[model samples]
Target: MSYNSRTIDLILKAQEPNQKQFTTFQQFFKSNNPPPLLFEKNITPKNVKAQRSFSNKTQDSIKETKRKSLSQLKYPEYRMLKIYARIKPGECQLNYDKQSILIETNPYNFDRVFEQSATQGDIFDIVAKQTVDDFLNNINGCLIAYGQTGSGKTFTMFGESSNPGIVLRTFTHLFSRNQETIYVSILEIYKDHVYDLVSGVQDLKLKEDLQLGFYVDGLKKIKVDKLESCQELLQIAEENRHVAETKLNALSSRSHLILTIQMGKTKLHLVDLAGSEKVNKTGAIGETLQEAKKINYSLSCLGHVIQCLSQGQDHIPYRDSKLTKLLMDSLQADCRTSIIVTLSPESKNQDETVSSLKFAQRARFIKKEIRIATQKKTYRDLELEITQLKQELLETKQRMSQTSSVSQFQCRYTTDSEIPCTESLRLTYRSMTNENKENYLPNLKTQENNTQLELENKINQILVELQGLNKEQSLDNVKRQVAKINELTIDMKKTYKVLVSTQGLNNNQLQIQSQFIETQQEQNKQLQKIAEQISSMDSSKPSFNIAINNMIKNLQQQQKQNIEDMQSKLEKVYYDIKKNTTVQDYNLNHLALKLVASPNRQQQQQQQQQIKRSQSKTNINPSVKYLKNKK
Candidate 1:
């Protein structure tokens, strides 16, 4: 049979009564059925009862076994409900049933219900208002709408034609508040690819270098100035969303969408994940099948991560999938986070509802410190303001100098110089007119006054230029200091790298030294063993003499060789120490000396040599031996 046929048969057999027997039958059939048995066509009720008695007992035993298993089973601590239905019109309703506006809808009614309710102040308005208030208060905030596909997740998040979406409402509120700085970056993670919906060409051609990982440890942030721009960006992203036809709905999102809003220092991440669907229900084919598989794998990994976290397992498998890994920081208890779970209330979607509910329930147990970190303006803005002030001051100073120069020129002609010349002076000048002073007096006075005024203006201009030069010089000094600081920073980095390398080298050297010490210890043990062997030999007569002689000779040779080697190593060490007597080198020398000493052998050799010398002296005397024999 074909592989597909075999797979189908296996599935069918798995569902059969007497599963073990069915499996056996399947295996036998696969093996071409080596033997077959035919049973009796009919039996009496009494006979049947007798036959079934044994089976009944077995069934009872099996039931008891099943009961034990049931007893051992643990109920889920949290339930995750995954909504998987579409929002069709007329399937849901909206009413102010609860204190807050109540939206009663299944997946089918989501879009229509959201349209009608959003017109009357929907959940988006509530969340947006809260976010705006938070923004104004210098607190960081986030509002995320989460739900399955075709469940009006998109519509609720971003409403239909008559109503604006959460994103639009948020910006509208933000603009209205006008109290914070906002930047928005819209992106879609489709097939593990991040695309910039805004700032790219209108042709939907994604820029090659514009891709960003959806879950980056350090994501670049965008700054938004106004709500209109944010809304425009959102519209662009919506256009870029990857949509495809599925069995359930057309325009089904094929990728996860993330819209990030950065307000000053705080970041708000609004994520709309693609609805998860079972492959059999999706009826996905070809590339869609592959895409579905990847989606399911990632989603499953996310589920596992959630499960592990709920269980307080130390090993959360975030690294198993990109999605989980990216969410690591957000999921951490330190990060202030809130999850809004949207669900389809349809009874037909019991499984999806349960899954989504369970997910929400698990999320409820996750205790996070919900602190809204308000973004504080950095020094850069202050610096810019200071620069602008300086420029204005300089301009004012220039204008003041020009005004002073003009006033000085006007003053030269005013009051004192403008006074009418005295008649007496005119007469005197007339008397001396022929003698050369009188004829040019008015011209000389005018020239002198002009020269004086010109001098004063030059002095004032010089002072202004000097002041400007001083300012320039001061600026240059500041620049020099900044450069010096940069150089120092570079040097510090270099020093840090050197320190790190040195530390690594030190650790390695320590390890090597430890190993060397261990080897020396082993050698010392061996040498002790050898010494014990030599001592044992000394206790034996003939063997002791021969062994002692051989050992003495070997020792003499070895001592000579070792002395030479030591001298060579010492000379090398001496030179090395002279060149660079680091603490490490000194330690090495001491260790080397400890290895060369053999205390036991040296003492024994000295004793033996002394005895031999004494014996030789006694033998030379000769009379001693004879006298000793007579006694």
Candidate 2:
């Protein structure tokens, strides 16, 4: 048999099923008297063209199916799917506008579509601002970024360079609008293992709390004061995140990163999912391959959950995967959610892009039952706030009183004619006091010092009684003490007001009056100190109460004596003024007597006793005349 060169080549290239066929081919090729073989034409130009056309049509059909699968999704019409087309590596053509992406014959519709050229600011305004607003209104919100490996999921959620991403912007807006404390926690889920990125807790467990829902056990939650603080933490978490090199991406995150922002009762979850990728394409090996499988499985479980939620299925497989379990609370029907599905425009990543779109579509059908978290303030917090405000008010009032007193004193001395005091008498008294400081200062000082000792003894007795009262720790006793303190404070204020009104004296009288005023101020200070200590007392620390009680009782007794002594001195001065009508200013004397006569009932009882004893020694008719003239 003779064989053509083409036939021989075909026979050599084709594998033989049996040894007989191979032996026959070898014998035919070696023989010179080979059979003449006519070569059969297996391929024609027309057939080749037809096959190429079939291949083209089949690809078109596949592309059309992918487009229709996303576009023809029968999800809930109330919520729109937000899709962003990220320019993948080696992508040349931009098939996306600001609103939608064109995929062959069908357009993948979205609420808003961001192209490769879109800025972080643009994305923040379109997507994040609304979420921040919802958060401000106490709405439970979840914003998630999902895509394939190297699809810019992290960059979208947390941007690079100076352009801030959604999480930072949300914090900035939240703090700017409301100055409430913001709490933050960062964690990553890998291979069904949860780890704290902030505190470096390894193998953190997911715990289902009845009150807090699903939370990572032992996760470190930090109280953030400013946007810069949160940004710093985010950087730290990024450094601590589980990431490694892969065939698909040089620095691919191997775990799902969940950033939770707690604002009072409302919680905002910014989740950046590990991009779904093909195990074969990623070329993962050993532990990397295992992690990739876990990532893919958890992500697939999330999709299944979304589908079940969209279909209103009862048996939604939330507990099937750790990722889904963590998201179960945030993805509920009542939560406000937004999913940013990143895509690649490159033809090479078409498969991943289609899969991501399908997942995003499934998420869009889920009807989130939008609910705002109800914030409730505990009784203790409210009580603390009230106490804080009261302290502030008291301090402010003290400051105002000091300022007003200084202003009044300056006004009285600067223009003596406007007040009841004669300017010459004032100068004379100023000179006398300056010269005779040793005489006046020491005498009053010694008296005040001695009064302090006696007052201290009485205060010690009061404190012993107070200690006994406090030992009961009964609410009724606390209420009674508070009421008693309030009554005492009111009486002190009244006495101080009466003393303040008795101003406008000559220089000599002013010196005496200032000494009295100084004594009253000291008493007021003691009262304030005691009141503050009582107000700030903590029931848990009984030692503080006993110490404050012991320290202030003597001061309280001294203040009571000082007030009585001041009234007595005022009455004596009035009698002296009545005896000496030769004094410079009759108006001053009249004003002083009128102020002394009009004391509150607490002072009246003491004054009445002093009046009966003084009636025989001094005629009251002149003082009564001074009071009537003043009126």
Candidate 3:
């Protein structure tokens, strides 16, 4: 039959009411048989209930991996933070409509909203009481306050003069509760530099150890067994804190301050972060601008770390800033942290308020893996450990000695002369026994003496070489000293030459002055002689008298001219000496002043001697009298 005719007949027969059964041989050719199936198919049952069941299991697995339950742990666990909003007084207010908008913001939600009337005590009671209790119970806890500039963040965390804040209240409570040893360490991170507030170390470092997770390397820890002591330390630290005047806040903190209180193994960290101020809004410039940028950068790094933790990200960059690095242990997966977000009611601070709220919101999702700090071993415990270790060591030694092969193989020592051969050493060691220890000891002593002698000989040789080196060094030192002496001698010779030149100049000046003085005396004597001659002439010779008067006038004119010429000569000599002194590389200005004030001590003495001689030779007054008498 044709393939098309057989297929059409089979289809038509299958549609009939009663189809006859075909025999095995005719089944293939029967026209009433249904068409042959092209391929076999396996059908799966569609059960919506079973599919939903599998989908739920897959979701549960994902959820379990995403976040494990902390409730199952026996140790203390960290709780998610709830927001607390307190609008500061005397500040701008958010409008009713804006308030509604802010409340509607999903991430800006808070557990408690306090109006402008909330007190410091109320805020502390709500935020810090539980943390205090946890701290007392030997659990580490942290309470941090964050907000905008001039939002009263420090005032709220530390309080003003009249109002006491959480820190004081916590101190009072701890003191009242019992006598506990409290160690306080206060530090600040300013402009990316870590500083100790209590110790005044401007630049400090952070160190991490296996036991203490992260600590400031050179931070000062003060032990305060009394409340007064705690107060004193707090006051000192506050005095040391870095504060600056900003346009936004009068006493604006320029750094992040962290105060850690340790009681035995438990600790409590109270951090007050510098307010978040915008560069433009705060009107920050220069140093203030730089500080603002660093503060913002560190806060941003902190925010990034929190965001990563909230979203279950693998990597958290804690090493981005010094503040975050120091706070690594407090912000890690094993800390109990609480953040108090302080806000300003001012509409101008709306952006900062929103930022702070969002920061606290992200922090709410962080579930730190909490565990108690390991306690240090006591004296008794240490002593027990030492005893146990000693016993174990003895046991090990005895076992080693029992195993002859092991002992012999491991036992090896070197002698002064012999080459180090392990096989020979082992043979020698095995040959010695307890009974022969006497003989072995003597041989060991002899070998030790030989080694000592060799060492002594080597040391003597080294000493001799060192002595030779020292002698050579001494000779070199002597040569250096001689060279230095020669250099000093040359300098002294130059100085002496300058002195000789100055003396010669002074002597020339003195000689010139003496000569001028002598000339003046001679002129006086000649004037006396002329006057006497003029007076002695008879009045009858009127012409002769007039001629004599003319002669006297000429002589006086010559004396005036001679004095002027001497003055000119003195000025020339002075200028020449100045130029020569300068060329000789001496300080001529000072020397010139000295010369003008008093030419020279020796020159003055010579001038006085010359004046005495002139006075003795020509008594000018007596000569004038004698000439008048003769006339």
lDDT per residue for candidate 3 within 1-631, as digits (tens), equals: 3235544444333322134422321364345343332111101122223333443454454444332222222563435344466677876554323122253335355566666788888887877887787666555678787888888779877897579787888888788864556889988999988899988988887788876877788788898878888788878888999888998998999999999998766778888899888989889999999999999999998888889888877888887887777777778644567777777877777778778878877876776664543343443444554465455445444433433442232334233223122232223333334454344534443443454454455445444444344334433443443344334333323322333344454666657656655664665566556545544544334475466446645654665566455545655564655566533223332232222223257864554454344445544323222222433
For residues 489-518, what per-residue lDDT tens digits would candidate 2 score against the true structure?
444344333433443344544555666657
lDDT of each: 0.48, 0.63, 0.61
List residue ranges in candidate 3 displaced over 4 A: 1-82, 91-107, 370-631
Q: Is candidate 2 or candidate 3 better by lDDT?
A: 2
Off by over 4 Å in 2: 1-94, 375-631
Residue 443 in candidate 1, Cα distance off native in Å: 57
Candidate 1 ranges beyond 4 A from true positions: 1-120, 200-223, 312-315, 333-336, 372-631
C-alpha root-mean-square deviation, candidate 3: 37.0
The root-mean-square deviation over C-alpha atoms between each candidate and the true structure, in angstroms, is 39.2, 38.1, 37.0
- Candidate 1 per-residue lDDT, tens place, 1-631, comes to 2234454354333223366655665565567533122111111222333334434455555654553344344423321211112232444433422222232442221111233223315565544555555444444444444555455567656766477766677677777755445677766656665565665422222221222223443233467777666666777777877788888658777876667776544455566667777777778999887777776677677678777877777888877765565555456542334455555555555466456546655555544443324222233443454455455445434433432343343334333233223332232233332334433455434544554454455445444444344334433443443344334333323322332232333443344334434433543454455455553442324464465456445544543453344335434433444345455433333332222222355663554454345545433222222222422
State the TM-score for model 2: 0.47
